[model samples]
Target: MNIAVLIKSVVATDESVTVSGGEIEDTEAKRVINPYDEYGLEEALRWKESFGGTVTVIGAGADRAAEALRTALAMGADEALLIRVDERSVDEHATAKLIASAISQRRFEVAWAGHMSVDNGAGQVAIRVAELLGWPHAGAVVACELTDDGKLLVTRDAEGDSEDWELTLPAMLTAQQGLNEPRYPALAGIMKAKRKPLTELTPELLGVDLAGEEASPRTERLGCETPPARPAGRKLAGTAKEQAAELLGLLRGEAQALKGRG
Candidate 1:
């Protein structure tokens, strides 16, 4: 019943961001666990509590990213492992490969992670790792439980509804928003995390060939531009029927213009 949770360090969602030289400036921005990943970590911790097993938190990031793993330990994870990478040069492809390689050496029955990263919004890492491991996978999971027969009973969001799935051991799952409420680290747990095991490893240590051209970043950002400011709102005046007619005309005109542009 051992479980592993893939963690990511991202700029705080509420913090202001600046795009410089095709990358968001994060040197000074406060870093935290990806919100969705926190849900997955919480679910893993709960599963460990219920099933009596170890829970390990793993991440691929620069050295500073160890703070996020320490935070996970503070929240009750049994241990932490960091797959070190250069923050500036690494992309999702390299990250997934590095993580998959690191995970291949670990012994566990389940792996958990967020559906996507807040900064990149690319929800491909967990699925790619699952594929690399040749394991069954489910994504955007909102609810899950371990049944008596050693199977996982899971419910995942499919658009507005949910899809139920049952899987055997060694499965990967990505947490959605409604999965569960994440717990904050208490004083005791925080102190305990200071002493909990936190190991760091490089891609080469995992037998990943990052020096090869194939391991290089597959995509690059040219630049980032702020979205154009929205147009100001206007108030419609006149009798109810007159206002309705005017609004309908405006809607029709707007739709027609957009259609023409398309």
Candidate 2:
């Protein structure tokens, strides 16, 4: 069971976010392992413990992203691979391409990643990487098991429901919330992680063509603005009938305002 887990470094949620030129200015923002990706790492570590194999953590980002990989290593991953993308901004497509290329060079039975990164919340990279590798993908997986006949039994969230699936090896799975509680790195593990093997690769080394017009992002952000402040809640201070009538009146007023805008 040679498992590979994808981890991402994300801006801490408690920090205030500031956008500049349609991008978040996060140069000095406190960074941590994406909360969702932590589930993926935890699941992979559990699999390794059960089946007895190596777990490699893979990531694609700038240099600072190595810290997240280090954290994963501290959490019991055997090795870490950092696909260093020189560009400041990387879309989901490019990220998938880079990671898929790196995974292609290694022998892996399964690839795991978060359903979405907290920073961007696109939730597309794992599926896209599966497409690039021509493998089956199960997203939002909350439970996973390896069967004797070499099949993956996974339970995943389908909208508000749960679905069970059986997939073959070399497949991809995206971890959702409620999968498992992520374990914190112990002091001994943290110390060992400093000496773990961490490899860095470039797009050229992976034979990925990141240049040319075709490689450009399919979508571009025109601009970004903060959402309007939320209005205060209003208490209905009347009987049921009166409250219903007041709600209807408010709805009608909102409808008329929309009509006027149109």
- Top candidate by TM-score: 1
lDDT against the true structure, per candidate, is 0.89, 0.88
Over 4 Å off, model 2: 231-250, 254-262
TM-score, model 1 to reference: 0.89
lDDT of 1 at 140: 95
Taking all chains together, the TM-score of candidate 2 against the true structure is 0.89
Write the residue-wise lDDT of candidate 2 on 23-115 in tens digits. Answer: 667789899999999999999999898889999999988777899999999989999999988535568888888899899999999999999
Lowest lDDT block of 10, candidate 1: 253-262
Q: What TM-score goes with each of the models?
A: 0.89, 0.89
